[model samples]
Target: MVTLGVDGLVSGLDTTSIITNLMSVEAQPQTLLKSQLSATQAKATAYRTVNTRFDAIRSAAEALTSTSLAAARSASSTNSTVTASATSSAVDGSSVSFRVEQLATAKQVTSLEKWSSPTARADEQPKPVWPIKVLDSTGATVGSIVIPANATLTDAVSAINASGYGVHATIVQLAANQFRLQVSSDGTGTDGARTLQGADETADDPQSQTVGTAESGFQRSRDAVNAQISIDGTGYVRESSTNTFADLMTGVSVTVSKADPTATSPTTISVGVDGSAIAAKVKALVDAANGALGVIKGYTVSTAGSAVATLQGDRALVQLGDSVMDAVSSAIGGKSLSTLGLQLNKDGTLSFDSGKFTATLASDPTTVNRLLSGVPATTTDGVTTAAVPGFADKIAALAKAASNSSTGTLVQLANGRDTLANAIQDKIDGWDIRLANRKDTLTKQFTALETALSTIKNQASWLSSQINQLYNPNKSS
Candidate 1:
């Protein structure tokens, strides 16, 4: 057996192992730095999310400043319900009549007139004749004619048109096929009505019996009705002709053209207003203050022994909530509901005093507007930007200071939230890039160390083999 002491080679392997261990140990600081970077990035992301949500609450609080619930709900149209009367009447000279009914009822009306078959009124006897005369321009005696009773008006018009007279005749259909004839002068003042002959008997000679003129008597009338309604206990009159109401409140319109007056009872219509739709548009100087107070309160909450403490104590969330709520709470104009005939409850709901509201409205509506619009009177020391924490001034400053697309205070808040989120993301991206570079460097160094260890192991093995061959005396022989 060839004796070979392997302590040296084993020691070399141990040394290589020690170098690999040292590499791993040296990379620990890099790993720790990466973990710290990751934690910082996560914190930034969390804060950004909080900032975005904080702004949303601000918007929701602002929506509460819309027109009062009653004002919004009162916006609607008026309806009409009228009953017509059924009776016959004459329309003589200049006479007009309108029908009226109970405010919520419908009425029906009708009229009538009569005519003989052709030329006589309904009261005329059979074989009767109508008086008609013909005259020249000089009023000279020309002719006379008679139209027999029981003749249809249509036949009389046709006969007159066919006659070789200086006048033309036409029938007017007053209703379905009901006829009445009208005559007109065919020539200028003197030439017209000069061709009529005369009628001395029931069967007059056609040559000289034509009438110089025609006469008829007719009249008709029908009844019309309207409805009346009382709004807020005050009577409001409306015509049955149209159904529309305007400007019950600002930014509101209503139309009511349809109603069933024949129904036993009146129908009630409903209208609703969406406060949330306009919430963000309201000024919220007061809300911001209260929200900030809440944040301060929440931060002081203590966790019990068994319960885990929440991260709600973060100073950023506290400051953000305080900033938004305080801004709204300290806004100018009427901050409390009492100024507008409404009372705020502890739970944040408003109670309306209808009588007081109406009285105040009746006396002065400008006050109401001032109370709602946040436009403070000169006597009132309006809210200042400082009262709302730094929010009001900050937002105004941001709006004026920002050169971006956002110009309004609300837009500034949104832009700020976006900027915060982007900042957090940028930090994360930067950290990721740094970690990736560090990881790459560490990987390359470790790979090189592994290659060096392998080369040294191979060289040690070859040297040991050469030493064994050189010392082998039998192999040389």
Candidate 2:
């Protein structure tokens, strides 16, 4: 069908402008639906943002309520030569004094004879048997290496290194065309010494001389010794294979870097509660809570001439904020959050007073701990009363409830909004089809009207012409 326009040829009417005006009026409802859909999408995005904040707050709360918080300990050593570290299992407020008598040493050995050159031509050098035997501190033949005939000194060094006897071998060049093979124990201890000998010719003792060329004879270079330390005066002495002493004390490890047997002073190792660290963790919890509250406030605020708040008049967000505030204000161990330096502000968020918190920690740290993490309540009667939940516990529970995917408030609200928006979009689509059909019908009707008017005008003009011809026929002759 032809589309009617402003210049109707025979009807002399502005049909195009009229149809456009009517279509504009018909599209009002669809425009409103689209606006509502945009607002719903924005609201869903806002809810997701708030949900992320809630997750952060939840994690912070979990950290505050963990057992590690209460068991935290820090260790310090008075002497720089001594390094100490403690775990959560370490006893708090425990101190020990110890004197370093000796540090553990590793055993090393070097070839008794020096070679002319390490990288000399292998075929020119006198090679030992097919393989050489390596022995441990116990004089047992532990491993063997193959020194192929006519191989260089570097090859011998590589073979000795490949022998799995807990020893490392290297070629030490002394001067031009002069090198010595040195082997050392991989571990520091009296039991870590190693020896090398000819294959199938080892004596019963490690110190026994072996039959080989002067260049292949191994001699002791360094002696291995165990570490010795005296703790709490000379009454208690501890011995270790390595410089690091772990079993001397529970949950504490001390590494001895140097020996000072003649020194009159002993290194003091102090183990105590890490109050500042614990306080900082509590402050983190407060900060996270405030951040969550700030997000809620930002998305719910309604300012004049400003963009509409996505979560404006959202009861779920309002209730969530209120719940968090309630948790903060809740009493733990009969003490309010203000007592712990977490003060509530007028804008429904928390502010941490570092000075006050530090003072509280300095004065009575146990009280602060008990307040943040409550103890088991004493029962007065046989009907046992439940333990009081701490601020962190309450906050964690609230956040968990709000962020639960299956039944969370934000999730449910977002789902509901999505459903409504989809339904509205379906309605808008239907209206699109209906409006197109209506416009097509109108265009067809106007086209038909124009065709009828054109036919009538042509008939009227023909009749007038015929009547003139009939009346003026005699004049024409």
- Encode model 2's per-residue lDDT on 1-477: one tens digit a residue: 357754578888788876778888988888898898888888888887888788887888887774856677778899999998888888877888988889998888776567788866433433333466666666676777777766787887787777777778888887886777787888787767665565434355325555433225556678788898888665688887789999456788999999997778888898877767777788888888888888898899888999867788678898899898888777776788898788778878788887787788768877776677666667786777778777777888888887778787777777788888889889989999988988888788788888999999999999998998889857656
lDDT of 2: 0.78
**Per-residue C-alpha lDDT of model 1 across residues 1-477, encoded as one tens digit per residue:** 121222124234443354446656655655665565554444444443444434544444333332332233222122343221111121112111112223222211111232433444522422113443544444554444444565455555555555544445554557653544444434332233333322322223347865332221212121222333333323444343223323222333334434443444443333333222222223243343344345334443445653322334655455544443333344334344454445434643334455565565546655544454443223336645422212233433322332123453334544554565566556656766765565556555555555676788899999999999999888956
Span of ten consecutive residues with least summed lDDT in model 2: 121-130
RMSD of candidates 1 onward, in order: 20.3, 6.0
- Candidate 2 Cα errors over 4 Å, as ranges: 1-26, 104-171, 181-220, 223-228, 233-243, 303-305, 329-334, 346-348, 380-386, 428-477
Question: In angstroms, how far off is 150's CA in candidate 2?
Answer: 10
Clash count for each candidate, listed in order shown:
39, 0
All candidates: TM-score: 0.34, 0.72
Error of 2 at 49 (Å): 1.8
* Model 1 local distance difference test score: 0.40
